[model samples]
Target: MSTTKIGWIGLGTMGIPMSQQLISAGYPVTVYNRSKDKEATLKKQGADTAATPAALFQQTDVMIIMVTDDNAINEIFTGKEGLLSAGVNGKIIINMSTVSPSISKEMAALCKEQGNRYLDAPVSGSVKQAETAQLVIMAGGDAAIFEQVKPVLDKMSKMATHVGDVGAGNVAKLAINTLLSIHTQGLAEAVLLAKQNGIEAATLMELLNNGALASPYMKIKGDAILADNYKAAFSLKNIAKDLRLSKDIGLSTPIGEAALKTFGAAEHEFGNDDLIAVKKYLDK
Candidate 1:
């Protein structure tokens, strides 16, 4: 493995734990978040901090971003004092944000023009998975670059796969999340039906857990919903965003469209809560 310094941008639910995995693996990591408060926590955990993205980029050859959306990505990468303002020769930039495929392609082209490699490497899994380094990372980039970064990626992901060239990662992510959103909503409805028909929510979930329909998502999220614990593994609003993305990506997804409406309502009511809160919309 090359002694390349790792730079992390973003410290939200997923980013914090993912970065910590790299640090715990003994990588020299420098982190930057728009909100500087979390930087102190990460700094105490053996990671370095920079006041700006440009400053962070100045000190590292490999940068990983896990910000919220395209707007955040634009501001952090193209705004004043952004990464592009810094010299980027021989740098590898991996964007793990859940943005549109087009933007990833554009970012990759721009970085290529500046003699840097860029990868759209969004992840699948919730915060718990992130903390446990069990994320499934879908990467889209040059295969050589993907190979070079696989070791570092493995520190944060149980599976890191190069799906294809630029834009493919987000495309793959959108497709996956379409099923996720619909399935989550379906789970919500099942809980609602169980509760409404006098069957205990816990019993229904227990039966589902033993059946072929159960998944890792259902096991964790099902228990959370049964307990009315809305603490987010994945925020309802974020899943709603992904639902909208799936709809907009040129797919005539009627099921996704319906799921989007259900999640959209739940997001409006409990946007910051766990996606399991979509159950709140189910009975009402």
Candidate 2:
């Protein structure tokens, strides 16, 4: 059995719950969140909290990063007194945050120079999935190191795919989210149009459920739209962030540029509410 302890950084909305799944599985986990109050739940689940990212660096065999964006990810691995300072020899760093693929490669290079390993294992699911270990994980890294982390990953995901090397996982995540954004936005739009065109939304939803358009995601979220409930299963702000990252990836392609403009408008219109509220923007 691998006796490696885990060091987790950025225990925010998604991180806290995911770290708990590890602790609940009886793994020795040390966590650091810039904010201390967020550590409460992880602590209850048997995680030892560190006040600063640097303070927790040398404590584990694998360090998992789950912060918000690329900048935060870079700072943790290369910042003043960051992981590089603590030394990463024989250790692995698994980044589960949604970051730009280019940044993932940069970190991979840095880790190689220092004899550490890097895995970009971004997830697709919300806070609720993190709590239940039902998230889908897309990973990119050396296959050997991925095998090493697979045991722990099982505690966090219902499905974990090792996509390829270095930045492939990030690319896969972006693709998945892009398709999800396109589909969800379409579903939300169709529901709105159906209702406004003198159609009973629930009946339309039932037909959708029984017909070629049926998907549990469509049915459930579509119902939320009809009921006008925009609860934040995944916040609009975060999805906007992903869409923005996707836009950055697609910058050289004209079609992608247009899609970026469209999603950006939705983000601007929806602001910080639930992602399902994207329907509001598609409405007009």
Candidate 3:
């Protein structure tokens, strides 16, 4: 029953659905996006649309940003017409993008200096999970602030946890994405091996799904691979970006190296395709 007005930036796949959850829950929402056309649909659904980030921040108590990367995040929050220009006093900024922990820490510090609260709140899940509000959100920031936003976070995710202090959410996201990359690559390699040895790829997937090897990702993405559906539930290029971020974290990842290379190549060839499309590279 909190009357906090919400602001949303970014209108990409996950951003759209995540914001919809808030709007549907009867929260007053003001939204802004780089492309104004994307606002058309939200505007019709009882959400207010702002012309710029500064304008959106003016009417918002909590702003949820779900942009692509760190660069995009910096652009909207620091320029002449950015969020800071309007003052962030008493505002809570939650960043839910996959980005570097270092950058998240830097933004958190800057927001703190301006008397605002910040959270590094990256999410785990793909398009379907987002649409269903089943994402796992890992948030990092002050414990009190996290408690303040947990209800709002709950409306957008199945589980939202305060993992640690500032920057910890990105760290958790990178580690999770590393494992995601490894699982996807391993699955692709196995399917390719089966196909090459006269075993049907679909058959192998069926067996795997019914056995202890079954995973939510394997079941979902494996079906997509089997049907040759690469409609970008999660793009190969983004996974490559996450893999690069994982490496930059300075963790030793001998297994991830090969998976990264495979995904890097898949990105080079099929950047916009679904991550399951890595199976195509292996099929060749």
Candidate 4:
């Protein structure tokens, strides 16, 4: 069993399984979520629960955050009864949320002011990867602090890479998500074109899966399209948000612009569905 005490914030789709990985690895874990009901699963797995973010900080040495959007990140850190409210020192805070680099830098400054350490460590896999402990973690922060938390991070990921100083992880996450949007949109377009010309969806998926263009993403999402399963593993709305964040960070190429427009249009009806649901939108 590892000796580092971990405090986890946010218990959404990805957070619950990721924290469970640490617990399975035998590190003591304490979790906090705005919705108290979400804490039950981890608590059942021998993990402790905290009433608030500040209270969690007091109980743990390393704090891991995985929430939705920039506003939620801010609320968890600086809102009433937040981590800084605990006035703790030397606590390492790793934010695994997909938020903007600017907000990460701002939070890092605040953490530094309060004599705490901060790392922006956003991940590259969906809920499946998180559940299986196969996530790819791109982290940004002090190199030494990263090494200090590497063992703890290892329990939740296949690899944890320190990309650069604060906010680089957010930049890396946005870049990869941009490509994910383009790739998924392209796959949807290709399938639609083939189906319109009288080719079967299954036939095209088989060809794509066996050809040089194959990938785990293509396989899984293609199967989802075949089964007509539009459940949200990674939602269309979140990708739209990532594209908007990429635009703010100066992603203005022709392909990027088109992808942004395509996803923006799809956000209304299919936003809550899987990103592969772009096929349904385009087929409409």
**Candidates sorted by TM-score, best first:** 4, 3, 1, 2
Task: Give the poorly placed runs of model 2, Cα more than 4 Å off.
Answer: 251-259
For each candidate, what TM-score against the reference?
A: 0.97, 0.91, 0.97, 0.99
RMSD of 1: 1.2
Lowest-sum lDDT 10-residue window in model 3: 250-259
The candidate scoring highest on lDDT is 4
Point out where model 1 deviates above 4 Å. none
lDDT for residue 31 in candidate 1, whole number 0-100: 95
Give me the overall lDDT of model 2: 0.82
Provide backbone clash counts, one per model: 0, 0, 0, 0
Model 1, 62-158: lDDT tens digits are: 9999998988988887889998889668899999999989888888888888899999999998787899999999999899999999999999989
What TM-score number comes out for model 1?
0.97
Error of 1 at 241 (Å): 0.7
lDDT for 283 in candidate 3 is 71
Instruction: Estimate, for each residue in 59-103, the C-alpha lDDT of model 4 and write its tens digit.
Output: 899999999899998888888999989988889999999999999
Candidate 2 per-residue lDDT, tens place, 108-143, comes to: 998889898999999988877898999999899999
The most accurate candidate by TM-score is 4
Q: How close is candidate 4 to the true structure, as a TM-score?
A: 0.99
Query: Which residue pairs of candidate 3 clash?
Result: none
Q: Candidate 3 at 256: error in angstroms?
A: 1.2
Residue 122 lDDT in candidate 2: 94
